[model samples]
Target: MITPMAIERTFVRTRKLATLLAGATLAASTTLVAGAAPASAAGPCGSSYSRVGVYAISRGDGTRTGTLEVYYSSSARKNCALTYGYGAYANTRSWKRVTISRADGSQEDTDANYYTYYAGPVYVSAPGACIDVAGTVPDWVTRELNNVHCG
Candidate 1:
């Protein structure tokens, strides 16, 4: 006959195993979700642009819903911006927007519409001046950067 101490030890081991399994499952699911995006040959902005910045768009509860990405093309003296939906929002039609403006108030470009994946690739040729950028995703925070990326 098994003793009470033996049964208690077995129950403790079982509980530990269950906790480990739960942690491992959560990790694996997170990895899969993060890796699901298809690789792009020219990136989101294009072959000529290099990513310079990224800002997160989050819900009131701090759930990340999207990102605002900024890319720069030194050769063209231009900056491009895009708003990309994340996780459950990806590949779903939603209101998205991206805007870019020069600090001098000379040029402003905006792209806003219902998009499956992203908002834009809006560009502004700022050259040596600073630029402002903004992005929005439905039901998420609208993020903005002002007078940034000077040079």
Candidate 2:
């Protein structure tokens, strides 16, 4: 499953057309290549750039848990985020009740949580508006799924 991190923050910045070149789309699609070229490859998103990152969080409430991270800009006009949930780990519970809180008041609360045991980072770029997350998806996302399916 895909996790979404919700952070809260405001910023303003120019939308630079940055390129993200990858090695092989089919091979390393889910894998994040380190120090990749600016326009090496496209991400698992519609936009040319990947902003939001998702991760799964282990909860103690029998119910599944997860987190989100919304990235902010300098001018308070641009923002992005990342998310992940428990389904990615195969928990079996819905992860919609989850939310990620950022330093800003902006929020990130979801009405659905299909992730329950599997989790990973879902990259997405926006039009500089939804950069306020509600919580954090934890660092384990990178540590756990870093090389699981990545080639």
Candidate 3:
């Protein structure tokens, strides 16, 4: 005793379930894609320095628009950092601050500007100590990340 109305309702429910499943799969895949990137993928200090850490800063729109990169030149026995902006902020006047601290209470801080795209391979004379980096991009669109250990 199946009615046409009953069949219609079943079909609608099946379609809704399928849609939900599809959305879930898409979201999961997006998460995987974002997480797949290695931290050092955007090294800015040339091939001589090995990228050790990266800190991302997001704007009010929740889009990542800037990055602070920490690099170590093993051959030179020094730690370095760089900052840059992306998207619409790129090539605009941007200000960034990077601080690298050593375990011995010594630190190097750089406040730099990008008239074009990026700033610094700012160096900190840290040797044989765990290093911490913190930075910010300050302007109409502001972002910051702190306490990143980049040994």
Candidate 4:
């Protein structure tokens, strides 16, 4: 036989369980969402250039094995980009490239092939205008650090 108090207690318990289930569902959904950008590559850019941006290359396996870096030199008033590939390959051809473009449509690109390790410190003069920079490695994909302001 159900009394008024018993009915009230059962209702309260059911409401608490429903609230817990909703919180759990929300937490699970949050974990399923993906991030928009990749993590930073590694280490300092170098002595001459200060790193401005870092982008990860998209390999087919969804690994963060390759990276692209953008740098700026206050003294020289130039911006540079570089590419890096982790793990040396034996008898495997690898290359890295960087491109910089000016607002007036002038552009500069530098590329290097490495049988051993790193690629280049490709540069362009970034003065008084916005510049776009991009980098690439062979057989993979390229990443861009879009229009950045430099004075």
Candidate 5:
């Protein structure tokens, strides 16, 4: 037999799990989506986001890599989250990118501040660094590249 308190706990847990699953699904779906404009190809996500810049790093092989940075600011302007990414490109010349999705497909909560980004690796890593790897882009430094973008 289940008591009311136990049932309530179960309901809460179930709701949390459902929310988690929904977030995961949204993120998975939006990953393949790309925005019209590209943010930064260089610099790590920081307080003063570059907003516009993408540095390139090439590997000897036919491959490339990049890093991206974005920012999120709370209402008080105190809490902030810096999101970054590192991915890889099979073709060095062409890029495999990740962009912000539209609100309809946003991964995170609409009210919560966040940034969407994608990156790739061009070379092997060396200690704290990866070959042909650029840093992140600062959110503060970007213009709307696409009508449907994540910020």
Candidate 6:
């Protein structure tokens, strides 16, 4: 028997369930959007530079701690490098280093220090030659790329 009170209770329950579902959906969507966002659009290298290479910096146990990124500016005929810390190392003051050099060793730039996030936008002019890129995080986890992005 569907009395007036019974019908009212059922409608209230249904409305509450729908509201709960809607809230859950909204929360999930917000999380997805936030997680999809990139680290930085232009990165630490600036908008004029385009990323040319990326190498992973890992711990002795093979856990990734950061990345060594290389960027190039064709108009400027220059290459740049940076070491970006992440995971357990992110936003914590630690030793970091980034270096970029011409393959001939004619030009080199390096930045090394205790940084919270990253080290270096070190630049080297390597227009017609290859470039060497390297970076280091804490505990001597260093990664390098040699003779890359030539001509």
lDDT of each candidate versus the true structure: 0.88, 0.35, 0.69, 0.67, 0.35, 0.87
TM-score of 2: 0.29
**Which should have the higher TM-score, number 3 or number 5?**
3
lDDT of 1 by residue, 83-131 (tens): 9988777789988888899987669999999999899989999988999
Pairs in clash, predicted candidate 4: none
After TM-score superposition, what is the CA distance of residue 105 in candidate 4 from its true location, in Å? 3.3
Residues 24-134, candidate 6: write the lDDT tens digits.
999999999998756655656776799888889997799988899888888888888999887888889988899889987778899999999899999998888998888
The digit string of per-residue lDDT tens for model 3 on 1-151 reads 9999999999999999999999999999999998877665645665568878777767777887677788888777888887777666566776755656674547766656654566676777666566666555655444433444434
Candidate maximizing TM-score: 6
Question: For residues 1-151, what per-residue lDDT tens digits would candidate 4 score against the true structure?
Answer: 9999999999999999999999999888776654422254233444556787778776667655567777887777877777777444222457666677664557676666653445666678868877877666655567766667556
Better of 1 and 4 by lDDT: 1
lDDT of 5 at 138: 31
**For candidate 2, lDDT tens digit of each residue in 5-116?**
2221111111221212322453475454543545655433223334434544445453434544333333333344344443443345443332332233344333233445
| lDDT, residue 16, model 3 | 100
Candidate topping lDDT: 1
Clashes of each: 0, 64, 0, 0, 19, 0
Task: Rank the candidate models, highest lDDT first.
Answer: 1, 6, 3, 4, 2, 5
Query: Candidate 3, clashing residue pairs?
Result: none
Per-candidate RMSD, Å: 7.7, 23.0, 9.1, 11.1, 19.1, 4.8
- Rank by TM-score, highest first: 6, 1, 3, 4, 2, 5
Give the alpha carbon lDDT tens digit for every residue of 60-134 in model 5. 452324333233322222111222323432223222332333323332211112234433211111222111212
Model 2, position 67: C-alpha lDDT score:
49
> In candidate 2, how many Å is residue 29 off?
14
